[model samples]
Target chain A: MTLVLESQLPLLIVMLTLGTVAKVRTVGSGGEPGALSRLGPAVLVPGRMQAPALLVCAAGELVLAAGLLVSTHPFFRWGTVAFFAMSTYVLLELRRRRPDAGCGCFGEVSSAPVGWRSIGRTVALTGLAAVSVWSPVTGWAAAAGWVIAGPPPWYAAAGVALLALLSPEIEELIDRVRYRAPCEQRHGPAESVTLSKLRSSGTWRAHHQDLVSAEPYDSWRELCWRFFAFRNHEDDDVVFAVYLSGRRPAVRMAVVSREGSDSLPDYIPVSA
Target chain B: MGHPSVERRRVLAAAVLGRTGAVPGADPGDEEPLRAVVGEVLDVSPHLITIETPGGVQERLVIAPWATAWNGSDTTPGDLSVGSMVLMRTLRDGRVVERIWADTTRITGTILSITGKKDLTVELDCGPHRGHRSVVIPYRASGRLQVRHPQFEPGYLFDAIGIRRDGASLALLPATSQPPYPARSVPPPPPAYAGTLSRIAGTATWSDTFDEEERGAAYPMLERTDTGCPKTGVSCAGLPYLAVGSLLQVRNVCSNRSANVPVVACGCMAGRFCDRCVECDTSPRGRIAELSPSSYVELGGELIKGCFNAQIGLG
Candidate 1:
């Protein structure tokens, strides 16, 4: 097969290999995507586990990329280092206490990380590729392709992989713009009550007001909020979490009509 | 932020014969002067009381309008009226009598802007000079030293006296505490569109047409308004267009400090939720209120500095 065809076909085989891994979800977080348990399921998939798949894929990638090098085309060779580096980084992230679970590498295909076994697989496969590099026939062919393809395959693959790593941050920011605050609100007739609205209002304040109130937050974080409901045995009281820049001196409420201005100001939390 | 300051100030004040250093003792001298636990009032006109000193003599003497008496309740003393039982200085033809805490700060606002007709568009932050973020002393008969003073534009800083503190801000001092700064030397043109925080340091005398029909006094522009907003979103009485905690975007006319602020509570009368607090603390306002306008307010950036309208990058 042609270098491109070999490389392309192996990518599919790798996908097929990974597809066999059973996806698992941790029971604790419900279905909330907290972190790496995302990849846990797929890694623990009964049949075509991650390590084997990565092994096949990396091996395929190495062979195809080497073939490309033999054709004196160094453009795709760097993919070798990139694939391995990404595999390693993902493994590390998965092992973290706060695992970065969103390891969606296959685009709309899957988000599971290739797993720990991937290390051994990569090591074995890379060694094979290295061994092949010394063969007289293989050497000459690889040399011819490398000389013709500009630099070596490592440069191209490494560059492409590096680009892949950073693109997510840019993409994430772009996605955030879509969730802008619903401005110019007509207020929807000002609903008096609702569970959805109630929670949303408080959630919004807790997010945004967290910044205003000594709490650690910024206004943007509180996009929507719900009113907090405090129930007494007799009546349902709604108390606004009044925002103030107060120190824990005391909680006294008093009003002072400041000088030079017509504004009547009140300070809460004093010698009550 | 208090106690000592209150003590020193009280010590600097006329001596009291009966009361202890503050801890509820008799003011020091004489027949323990007269002490009454009456309801808080506005003005103690026609009569006043004298605070006794340890030396059996009354000294420094407080002015009636200058003192404030509090009512033992959750209610604010601002609700008290001149007819309310206020602690005051009994004076005979402005002579010494007694010093009592009256029911008022008597000073407010740091003047942010000034208008013609002696009306001062000030930033109401606290008592006395609390909200007057800028000083607009009546420099000339023609009002040359008013809001649009030639030598006192947005960037020009001037010295002013008689400023006081308010909630979490400062106001213009009385004609007394004026600190010194310079005028623009040349006339400063008013900003194109000013925000509430951009008010000049002079007094504003606006006649509300609403008051012409609803209330009698112009209510000092925003002297007093209802706190609990009508849930119907239909404004009729003295309530604001928006309720407390409602989000608002304020733009400083001069420096353009614009940001979305969650309505903490209502400012005296600035439109919308003009407060911008990063924390829910009462002390900042108390401290800021004690500062004089000339001592605290800067002529640059948002005329009012401590509001959350400043946190979201407005200042």
Candidate 2:
């Protein structure tokens, strides 16, 4: 039973490390508000401070993970148990109050709203951490002690099975593997897909008024992009290329001069 | 892939800011090149290079000894990265490349607001993906821009062709004629032809929204109750009722080329533009079919030029 309890320490360390990396990466590259904003505790933090708060949480997880890997001290064990216990409580509150938001245990991948499976995983992690509070050896020591073992103890197998059953992210991994074909090679998107993406792009809206006719004069696809051309008010060709993949397909535009030259005269800046 | 060097970025920044000494002269070619090829670079060699054009055709062009390549600024052809988008100008031979612009970027959107007293700064709403961006209209170009864009207010649309510096887009040249009206006031299109016909005579276009090898057409008109169709009203008047898998016998009036293609995707977008095609002669001002790139080429349509006067019937 001691060995089984120690074995769970590595699992906690790994989960903590993953969470730390994901959170830190999200905070480092600033863009849209991350999954942290959707978590229940977000209401307590200002929008500008959300990233910093996520970084702080990640720092705590890293410290706990590093502490558990090298030391079997009661303090480290108890801290880990407390961390997961707090996590379980937070997830429960999120589920009850903001059912539409995720616990944000991971980063963007955890943006899938609070679910029974996520809460179950947190609860199971808390139980695992509680059992590891009595471990006598560090996570690294327990891992080293498993040299050519006949089989893991029944409890280790049971713990792994429970964690697997509670992890809904596994289905996404399976789907990715099942449909691994490149975007262009797959049965391409519908015409409406490219058109809608083009319409939503900044390039389209900017040049929309200059178009001579209401509809695109010509359009064609090449690889992962669909190109649409329209004559501008100046009779020059205004062409747009919409990327055929991703949630927001990238759109590009080029205006060919009526004389067919690729170059447009430079704009000479002067006081307005 | 390797990115444009910092020195090149600085040069592009200077060029965009209208400080012109760092900018290089245009590619050493005729004033008017026959074609401008836009595509992603696939393969490159010292003497030869290949690119997948927007029409999905892999074009192999001879890299002229004098061919100039620019990413953010003047660069060597060897420095061009695979998978980077490029705009190339070919010499008269139509096979030898004379110029290449790599990773060229463009910005088009509505002017949300304007700031700055000397060098005017314009904030643009570049739609959802790009969100908002701020561009500097260099003092040198401000006068010319204001003359062209008279109503440079918040509601009017703005456009510029430029390059990306770091992660931000820098607007270099006006990409299109600026309309004086608000973007929301685009003139309504003439009503689409609503009547049905057995043989539709109109412009046929191509879209790359399908496998390159697949031969098919996306008919603008469909049976009202067809599964997989969004149940939108018929897109064009001349189109006959067609199903998803129906066959279309298409002929290009200009080339006299013909083929039978299947209906593989939707052409709801094509129905919106009621405009004529003057490829050979004037085609009726409504799109009848949107063909896959391969099928479009097979029916003697040049993908870059965009359309062909087409006649189609149920096959």
Candidate 3:
């Protein structure tokens, strides 16, 4: 059990942090943003209890996992007790909101085609968490386990948990958010009113030259960009947007205007 | 019994089952949306606003609470406050205004494109209906790109910049002002700009931190990676990953709803694919009925939902 916990340590820590972070940002955000955002809150039932309950359950697992990894007998038992106690809290919360929702105690852990014995282990572990808290002896065992293992194990666990993915990965995503498209429900339905396509290409004196000289990129890709040129009376002036996917394009930005519609300007400026 | 879009395969998922399996995370545009001034309302259950375009077209829009609704209000449409302006994705929802935020949410447009060497050149495209139009964005901006593209040609009119709104409007929490990118005027593109066209392939990497107010606007991107799933049958490599506090498109494998969330937790595989999530075995159906204040993402395909961080592809 300890070895297993140790191996899956990174994932477990990430999960707990994720849970906490998820609850924190939206904790007080009120109802979920929409049907989409509501998915997290909907399950395990709704109300304040769900987030806290999940938090406790995960935290308990985190603590228990930490103890087991160290192989500290005393701390292990105590940690087990704490984990069960926490799980009990989670299950209680779940029961309050949704009794039918099976205890998702071991997410992906229990999903993979495992053996009957594994199921038994899961049942036992869940009982430890969902049924009741641990006894005094178990608590003592966890405490002792922590002693033998020392602070190093605890610190290591903490450190590993904090760093889930590389930093560079976060920097790689460039979201190009466009609104007022002809249809939000329709995919690939962006309204791109080009100069030539708009008959407005005649006034193309080049307003976005700044972006042209921004830099000499090594690569780029056309994620998605288009100027909205709906009705001449439309209020949207969305110029084309180019997110550096792989390489830089020759004309990075373009204005969306009708053939003769100057309701705005022939071209706007691009700032690097 | 089932959705026609699903059976007809007209939806984006038609490709989901394709050879390459249409990649899941694809962002639409670059600048914040300009739309019908859906007049604002106070504390509407789902936060509604009336968007009135210059043409006097009044369309209704649903929005999230400002300040996280960490604070709520009950002001009526008649009590329109100064704190309302929506930064939205320029996509319409059936005629009902549908970008994330259309009211009071300020938005900016950042332009990026490919250069000769196959690297990405990003430019800041900003301002209202008139600020930008004549010129194309240059290849200069602060940030990095993924692997260089193969086609090292030039003169490619790749794409534009815009914003996606989470609600109809958002406020500058007095403590913080507006986003960093200010509107700038620029000269026209060199005539040769069109002559430098080329085919490029790579990724865009926007830098950010916690104070990343613009993270919601530009930091998150959909990656076009050719890399397949890991042989072990797992990969978050290609989903749309968001920066901290940015909205994430998390698709639940069990239920079909793709939850759009903030980047509370980082360090995952770019938040591309979530390998772990806290789930309840509750019936997705029952939960759906109970789940109120929802936004429907009408994709070109069917709806797939679940708890948070749901993955869309097959194992």
Choose the strongest candidate by lDDT. 2
**Full-model lDDT for every candidate:** 0.28, 0.64, 0.28
> What digit string (tens of lDDT, one per residue) describes model 1 on residues B146-224?
3323433333333222212233212232222121222112111122221222211211111111111111111111112
For model 3, residues B239-262, the per-residue Cα lDDT tens digits are 222222223343333333333323
lDDT of 2 by residue, B1-315 (tens): 112122222222222233332221112222342345567899998788899986888988899898878775578887898988776666554587777777655455678999989778889765432358877776766776677577788977776555555555555555434655455433222322323344768888765455534567777664333324442223433454444554567878897766667666556545544555777999876677877655665565654445789987655
lDDT of 1 by residue, A60-122 (tens): 554654454354333333444455455555555555632434343332123433344344444
| Best-to-worst TM-score order | 2, 3, 1
Evaluate candidate 1 and give its CAPRI docking class based on DockQ. Answer: incorrect
TM-score, prediction 2: 0.37
Better of 1 and 2 by lDDT: 2
For residues A211-239, what per-residue lDDT tens digits would candidate 2 score against the true structure? 88857654444335555656788877666
lDDT of 1 at B76: 32
Tell me the interface RMSD of every candidate, in Å: 21.0, 19.5, 20.0
True interface contacts reproduced by each model, as a fraction?
Answer: 0.00, 0.00, 0.00
